[model samples]
Target: EGYGLTEASPVTHCNPIYGRRKPCIGIPLPDTEARIVDLETGEKELPVGEIGELAVRGPQVMSGYWNMPEETEMVLKPDGWLLTGDIAKMDEDGYFYIVDRKKEMILSGGYNIYPREIEEVLYAHPKVKEVAAVGVPDEYKGEVPKVFIVLKEGETATEEEIIAYCRENLAKYKVPKYVEFRKELPKTMVGKILRRVLAEEERKKMAEAG
Candidate 1:
């Protein structure tokens, strides 16, 4: 049960007690109209169950980003729709699911890969305590998913083992090409994984290697 933004007066949605999906952001709050639009254009509304950028309109939304007109215009449309950067989809029942951050999606061999989908598969493994999937540069594919995992206490796993497990659970292109074992992951005070920090580190290492 969650949905919020600095520009949306905070919460725009919440899961109800009777009908709710576990880990979902839930349905749009009262008076808030939500829609999923094309990720590239942000104009065409997508059909149900189709993943796209989430947009919302309501009284709670901010007028503009405090004189940052250009920045405000990018997200806050003239028609009162706020084009949220989050990738999401709506179910037939009207529940909303956050796919991942729009920028976090991977473009590999012309296929769109969502990091959250891969992370979900990794989380199913018994030894995994935490995991973050980031796109790394791949000469042939443009980019490939690289997973960094933190193992649970007293647990041990190998790169081959983890990759093999993923291969069995995910499509070939969606399988991570690289697996890194980390003692701990960078995070915010509230425990949100800092994936951008991990992406930066991967780029730095690749640059140095090149």
Candidate 2:
């Protein structure tokens, strides 16, 4: 596994040929230094196993986007660390696990909910084949998390049953307000789920209803 962004000029982290961990993006590459910084402040580094933004400093890292100073300042810190929008946690063994995306975090009822966290819970259901969770605008809470799911072949489940499964494994505030069944979740060419597409669809549906 490797971790990198366009601004980073490509690969930054990858598991060594000799050692690898499942679900880990791997250790920082040579000449690269990585840290998990607080999501809100983006200043203080968090301890091991704590989830936060993954920041990296290396020669391979880009100086800034061409001619986009304001946007550059948002991600490129003066101290030389590039703030990757990915939220992640590093274990003691130095392996990194991506939790979610900072911009994708849902703020609902004064709670910060990571869609990946809910997706993780939902994916464990025997009937679930695929799922994508997104934040939808809610009149009372500003935004509430909702999920779209695709069931496994020959499996079936009710909305209440799925919600109850999540409730058992997740905090109350983290529970999705709406559950939708889809023939299939949207995906990118590489087979990555496109949660933003679902979120935008929900917004349009709400607008049409209004």
Candidate 3:
């Protein structure tokens, strides 16, 4: 419905009351400027349809975090733009769509993979109630996607079946190499899945096994 962060007074973009596109965050509000920038440096402004970090500058944007100049400086650019740390793209119509978080992106075999893309495919499976795709340590590829799925009540599915389904819908590199079925996923009070927590758990498991 809307897109923003606490640093931006919590609201920056919202869908129009009418003619709003599904899953799009809509155009920037009055006096607010938003752009897609290079994910690496967050400096080069990307062209439309290019996936990059979303940055915003407006009156509602926060000046700085309380007594945390270093933390503030990391996000707030010298020119006043605040990097939202979200991987996003803008359509020709100016509607913005979030692909995923920059930090959550998986780099496997030199290919960039967004977890949301994988999660969306799994969510379409009738037996899957919820799913999260996270990058786990991989010796050959540096990192590979591993999916954690929560099956619908009274439904049963196997890892092989899920993998086969993904293989049909996704590229070879984007297909998850491992799967873990869970009763429920770690979530925030607002119901956002905690991919970072899952990723940390995988890292710990690798360390323990080694």
Candidate 4:
């Protein structure tokens, strides 16, 4: 996923998944450079595998954050790093991993939950043809992982079975609290599953029930 920064300049990260594997943004392109900064102090680099705001500085980096000088100054550090608002981390293999869409990381009971992990487990089920995981508001846990699934043709896996599998493969905090079976997934033209769309539908149903 090549994220565009206005004109699509400046850095951060890019994801190029060639298959069903959890894709990583590979090394920089020609003349492009990037770094991961601690989300708090914005100084120093976290070891590979730690998540943080991705910053970049290279020929392709934008000059500023548009006309928002204050915002620009805040993002484009005096040291020439353009703090792309995206959150990510690099791997030991020098590949970048996006944590969330800045807006999508779920803060539930003081824990930051990323959806990709749960989605990965769901993908492991042979019966699951497709799935999407999203966060829904929860008054108790603050938020919870909810999964919407599309099973493979003639295949069967109950919602409880799916949750049990997740509990086996994931942390207690990471297992989805809700599950839904779908006939077909809402997808982008390019075939990307849109979790946000399913989340909206889940919200509508929850609202109706109330």
**Among these predicted structures, which one has the highest TM-score?**
3
**Model 3, runs deviating above 4 Å:** 18-22
lDDT of the candidates, in the order given: 0.94, 0.91, 0.94, 0.77
Model 2 over residues 33-125: C-alpha lDDT tens digits? 999999888999999999899999999989998999999999999999999999999999888888899988999999889999999898888
lDDT of 4 by residue, 1-210 (tens): 554365235434455445332466666555667778887777888888888877777766667755789877777778777776678888776677766665566677877777887888889888888888888978898789989898999988788999999999999999889898889988899998887887788679788988
Instruction: Give the TM-score (vs. native) of candidate 2.
Output: 0.93
Q: Give per-residue lDDT, candidate 2, residue 5.
A: 90
RMSD of each predicted structure = 1.6, 1.5, 1.4, 4.4
- How many residue pairs clash in each candidate at the backbone level? 0, 0, 0, 2
lDDT of 3 by residue, 108-181 (tens): 99989999999999998999999999999999999999999999999999999999999999999999999999
Segments in model 4 whose C-alpha atoms lie over 4 Å from true places = 1-7, 10-23, 40-44, 64-79, 204-210
Candidate 4: what lDDT?
Answer: 0.77
TM-scores, each model vs. reference: 0.93, 0.93, 0.94, 0.78
Best candidate per lDDT, number?
3
Alpha-carbon runs more than 4 Å astray in model 2: 19-22
- Which pairs in model 1 have colliding backbones? none
lDDT per residue for candidate 1 within 1-210, as digits (tens), equals 688998897899889868546679899989999999998889999999999999999999999988799999899899999998999999998889999998888999999899999999999999999999999999999999999999999999999999999999999999999999999999999999998999999999999999
